[model samples]
Target: MALLNFSQPLISDETIAAMADTMRTGWIASGPRVLEFEQALSDTFGGRPTRTLTSATGAMEVALLACDIGLGDEVITSTQSFFSTMNMIVKVGARPVFVDCDLISRAIDLNQVEAAITSRTKAIVPTHFPGALGDMDALYALAQRHGLRVIEDAALVQGSEWKGRPIGSFGDIATFSFHPNKNMTTIEGGAVVVQDEATARRIEVLRFHGIERLEDGTRDVVVASGKYNMSDVSAAIGLAQLRQLPAFLAQRRQLADRYFEKFPQIEGALLPPRGVAGQSWNMFCVLLPFASLGMTRQAFRAALRERGIATGLSYEPSHLSTLGRSLGYREQQFPNAERIGEQTVTIPLHCGMTIEDVDRVCDAIGEVIGSKKH
Candidate 1:
């Protein structure tokens, strides 16, 4: 059997051409191209202000800083994350308090979040898990009622929508990633979109060493911002990807459909559920029936790799990690988060895959889950 890699980027001739254009301009870093890319994203996001960054982690840090959240302050985030969310909170001198995921939905439970909040709570980051909003309206409403900032870690949701609004459009502050593995790619990049102009300026300044310079060949215009500006090359690639995003999302949805249709019931393997909720389908993950499977999530992943397929877990639960421990988050602090982190398997889903590719991967999953049965 020919081995098909789990996931790959969808860069095309246009992406190369954009890179070539950036090379031809001789202004590779923070040039006109980045501005153009930002404008395109803003327009795509219903005119919301989106500032490109080196990575979503940086975006998250800057957004939190802009909101004036820091030491003695606490930010609420769920256990499902790439660790960067909690890390960012710590980076800004703030503490990260974790809550559990809704067992069936895998979204953060609103009640737990409400219970975690105290006077020191400054922000709430509701991560858009696997492309679904995770009850965004309620989270937003909660933040509004509490007067806390909301910076959504929507790294997995590029074209995902919430409550008829684009996920990036309505939050108090939002961040997203353009890593090669995400729904779209600028190779490795991110953006911070703010709800107000003043806050947006604060982010721009904080990202680029606080010394902002306009990319105009003019020598006198400086914006005194952080080193957060995107390179023209990266921006060009981002624009190219943006143009292909809608189509990419459609293809992902198609692949997910195949997974849903051909899914075989394995006692230990649980299919992701979709009710009125929709996923950005960023990653297709499933929980293993641990009791029957007799393998940890890591063991299961290694087992799949032996079959020449790639699989991974999106993250380790924040409250259970070393960094979390140093910050005083004990294992018992977030039992549900600890459990989800141990079991979730983030299988690959990217545009460079064919339906046959998806089936091959899906069959491999069934085979693994059925092995114990046999």
Candidate 2:
């Protein structure tokens, strides 16, 4: 039996062909294909100004630069997300003020976010947990009232919507990832959607090493920045992937449904939220009762591997990392995130997965944890 990998990207033949075409054109660097992909994404986000970048990390950093959020400014964000969310804030010389995630949804707690905000708070960076969104209405209202810029960490929620509005469509600034394991793939790329053309133009310069074009066709570097441009090769793949995103999301949702239905009713094993239809269903994560099962997460994963299955940890609590420690974060600072980080496992749920695949994973999990229950 083939190992059911935790996550996989669906790269169709057409996507490969598009990549080949871009390579043959010899304009594989950031060029027309990148422009096309950016335009397509802009249209997808309700005509917001969009720019493609090398990664979502770059997008977030650039967004911070565009918003002038650096030097003693505090950026409020979740402690439950990938380290890049906090790292970007620090990269721009800003302070990252973290709030613990909600136990159920894994989104940042809005009340804590409000409490974390102080006089130095310049922006709010909220990450939507895989396929699930926090209270956007409340989040934005709070940000608006505080005159804070909101940069959504939308890495895993490309097709997700909030109350019928697309995630990036009306947000202040939203960054998306096209990493291979995401709902869509550009092999490796990301995009930023902004409210206006000026921010978009600034990002263009920021992404391409801060080189502003002069009238005589010469480029001048007004600010120090690194190159974070997306090549046409990646963009070609992204354009093809974007075209199939809806179908991909539908498949993911179906797989998620199967996981929910087939998952065993083990006591203390917390299931993820049964997200709404608007959710993009990026990956299915479950928090297992490892201590009760008499196994560590490592041992449980080893058992899954022995059963020809693969499992992954979506994240480790950023606040407990070495970097987080250097910044004065300590153990138990964010209990929910620390708990979820230790116990959460990402199971297979991808466009390439079949309903039977979900059943196989569910069965393996049942065997591994269910039978081991105290």
Candidate 3:
């Protein structure tokens, strides 16, 4: 029985060698390599100002803080995403206003977002769902109408494009993750793309203990912020990953195409929303129509596991989590997101996988769903 892991990083020998070179330099802590990686990301995204950080979560926090979104402020975002999207808002002493997701794209419903805006609302953090780009044009329009800042949680959308422009290129502020399982990897790191130099400098100071370097090499301790800097070693790996991103994206697309072709044959399993043209395909997830199949999501997963095919639940609705409930969020508030959360499951999709691997996973899924029907 072969156990197929749900996700794996695509690291090449070049990436490994870059990290080794950084290790040999002994200037591994937020040095030249980090700046180089930021420059590379900037070049990739049409010269947007970028800053490398410890993690996407940290980047989100810095972005919010830089925007002056804090106590008594309200931030509007979707309920159908990882907790960090909402959690970052809460961490900044702002209230997270929830909006339901669009069923097809799994991105935040912009219609609901406009209605949620109030005078207290200071920002909108719209997450680009796995392999999908949300309606940024509409979101940005809404933000402009309401005088709200827009911070894109683009954790899963490295190299994704919209209307011929890359994701990080046009947004007010876009944060990306370089986690082990994301489209690209730096072991664990993140970056923020800002449209202006001032915002970029603000995030840089806020990310590294609020230290502002004055002219003549004098350092001023500004606000006593936490240390959230990326290591040169990680940035070196990220640079390599950035260089290889096109090939990685191609491989992921090939595997995803195979899954799209094969999964439609299996009954009671629904493929995730189709990626629009120019969208980056991150993780290929499927929604099991458990109610129609007369099985719980757990049972469906267990069945897949019995055949040595591992599966993953992409996310649980943030509004239904412990933190969500504690903050006065009730059940059924965001019905669509809750529904998607219950049924969504991530299967194997990685650069190392082959077309045959996709077939194996799909066949196993079909067998399990078929046995349930009988």
Candidate 4:
């Protein structure tokens, strides 16, 4: 039996050929293909101002810079999210205020978010976690009430939607990741979609060393910025990936539904919430009742490894990390997020997975849990 990967990119030969064409063009640096990719993203997401960047982290940092969220300002975000979401806030010379996530969806709790806002709160960075969509309507309404900017960390939700609108289409700003394990791959790339032209222009300048080119080819130096442009090679791959995104999302949904159906056979395992209308289902994660299994998450993973199965933790809460501790975050500060961090396990879910593969993984999970139960 082969060791099933947690996730894999579904790169087709067409995408490879596109990359080859880009390499042959001799203009593989950030050029026409990059612009094309950005335009495609904008077109797909309701004509938003989208800019491709080297990574989602770069998109996030540039978004913060564009919003002028610096020094003395506090950016509220979920403690359950990937560290980069919080780290970027710190990188932009701002403080990241942690909010707990809801137990069912594992998305940031909007009520907690509203409560966390202070006079210094400049922005809200909500993460659309794996297999779920955060409450965008409520979050946006609260942001409006508090007059805060919203930079959605939509790294896991490229093709996701909310209330009949695409995730990036109507937000103040949203960033996407195209890492290989994501729903799509650009080899390694990301983009920021902004609602306004000014913010879009700021990101363009900030992504490429702060050099703003004038109509007559003159250059204006804005604030000091980093080189974070996506190369044409990557954008070529992205264009190809974009063409296949709908198919990729469909396959992921199929696999996730299979997992949802089979996981219930294993007692004490908690499946993801159902009826989530517009989720991207980037990762199919489940929470194990560790006490019932009489095993730690690591022990269960080791058992699965013995069966030629692999598992992953969706995330360990960012608030419990060394940096979080340095920033005065302690354990149990956000109990729901802490519970999710300790209990959640991400199973194999990707465009490449079939129903049989899903069944094999579920069977392996049942065996592991059954053995421990006996």
Candidate 5:
């Protein structure tokens, strides 16, 4: 049996051809293609101002910078997310006030978010975990009540929506990832959608060395910054990927449905929330009964590997990392994030997977868990 990869990008011939055409243009740096890609992204987000960068990490950093969040300011966010989520807060010279995630959806708990707000709280950075969103209604309401900025970390939820409104379309600031494993790929790029053109201009300046083009063809450094612009080569590939995103999301949903139907109900296994509205289903992760079955996650993965199946650890608790600890976070501070992080595994589910692939993975998991329980 072929090894069932946990996540795989479905790059088409059109994407390769577009990349070739871009390289042949002799202007592979940020150029027309980048502008076109940005425009297309803006349209996708209900004509919101959009900008592309090298990575979502840069996108979040730029969003924070554009909002003028800096030293001594507090940004409330979840502890369940990827390291970059917290790292970017620290990168922007702001304090990241961590909150625990919900037990099932893995979204940041809004009540804790509200409780953690302080006078210094300048922003709320909420991540849509693996395409599942938190309560946007309450989150934005809280932000509005407190007069805090909202920078949505929508990296895994490119096509996700909230109550019929698109994620980036209605949010204050939303950042999306186009990494290889995401719902769509720009090869290696990310985009940010802001509320207005002024902030968009600020992001553009911040992304590329803070240079403001002067009228006389001279360049002026308005503020010191770094290069994070997406190349035309990446933009060209992104254009192609964007065209297929709707279909890609549909495929992911179908695969996820198969997982829901086929995965056996082991007593202590914790599955992700099903039938979520507006979920793009970027990944289908589950918390297996590793501890209950007397098996470590490592051992469980190895068991699947023996069956020509691959598994992935979606995340470990970011708050338990060295950086988080240094920030005064202890082990039990965020119980839900800690528990999910320790036991979660991302199974095979992507645009490249079929229903049969989902079934194979489910069968293998059932075997692994069943054998361990015996």
Candidate 6:
């Protein structure tokens, strides 16, 4: 049997044709295709000042620059998501303040966010873990109260929404990834969406190495700020991907429904997520009961591999890592994150999965953790 991939991008002939068009245009570096992609994103996601970049990491770096977040600033992010998030904070010369996640939804704990905010806190980088934004409204309110810039690291959130708002729709700034494993792929692209015009303009310039431009129907003015802009080829791919996104999300949600239903009776061993309809279902991650999975996360993953299934630990508690230690953060700094880090498992989930595929995975998981119950 062919191994089910953790995720896959839906790139049909349309995507291929788009790439061909970009190549034919011959201005494939950073041109109309990029603008087309960005406009498509803004229209689809409903955010102003949306600009595409090379990757989410690239977008994040530019967002920090726009915020003037550097040199001793504290940017709060969770430990349960991707490591690149915390690394991006550190890359901007700022200290990444770690926050534990709420045990229920596995998103960052709001109270911890409130506590982590000091005078140095410049931004709150909340993640919608698996596209479920737990207590996101509360998080936004907290950011507003503290006058902190909210930059949702929405890499895993495409269709995700909170209280009718897309995760990227209302943030001060939001960065999203377009890697192959993501709900969509730009052949590798991302973007920074900002609510404010000036910040948005800053990101636009920053993405292209600080070159400011004025389009008077012909002539363009250049400026002294910009770096890391998206290429026209990538933009072309993104345009095609955006058009296919609705169907892509629908398929992922369909599979998510199956997984939730298939494993509902498993009790505490397999807790499913509950949220509104727009969820991206980016990663079908789950937490096994401490009882059933007697072995640690690594051991369970090894067993899954032995059964020809692949698994992964999305991330670890950032506060307990070497960099966190160097920053003087101890394990106690974020106990919830530390625990979730040790237990979270990223199972195979993608738009390409079938009902039978879900069933097979569910069966394998049941076998591994059920009969081996501690």
What's the alpha carbon RMSD for model 2?
1.1
lDDT of 4 at 130: 58
Global lDDT of each model?
0.80, 0.90, 0.87, 0.88, 0.89, 0.78
The TM-scores of all predictions, comma-separated, are 0.93, 0.98, 0.97, 0.97, 0.98, 0.91
Pitting candidate 2 against candidate 6, the one with the higher TM-score is 2
lDDT of 2 by residue, 1-374 (tens): 78888888988999999999999997989999999999999888998899999999999999999999999999999999999999999999998998898887888899999999899999999998765789999999999999999999999898889998889999699999989888898987889999999999999999998999999999899899999999999999999999998899888888888888999887888877885658888878899878877888999899999998888897898888898888899988898999899889998888878999889888888887766754
Model 4 lDDT tens row, 200-242: 8888899989998989989988589999999999999999999
Model 2, poorest ten-residue lDDT window? 365-374
Q: What is the lDDT of candidate 5?
A: 0.89
Q: Which 10-residue window in model 1 sums to the lowest lDDT?
A: 217-226
Candidate 5 ranges with C-alpha deviation above 4 Å: none
Angstrom error of the Cα, residue 154, model 4: value is 0.5
Cα lDDT tens digits for candidate 6, 270-363:
4547645556788777766554545667767777777777776666777777887888877666676666666677787886778888888878
Rate residue 356 of model 4 by lDDT.
93
Off by over 4 Å in 6: 212-226, 264-270, 290-292, 371-374
How would you encode candidate 1's per-residue C-alpha lDDT over 193-248 as one tens digit per residue?
Answer: 88877777777778877754558753432433346667899999999999998899
Residue pairs in collision within model 4:
none
Model 6 earns a TM-score of 0.91
lDDT of 5 by residue, 147-175 (tens): 99999999988888888888899969999
Q: Answer with 3 or 6, whichever has the higher lDDT.
A: 3
User: Distance (Å) between predicted and true CA of 56, model 5?
Assistant: 0.4
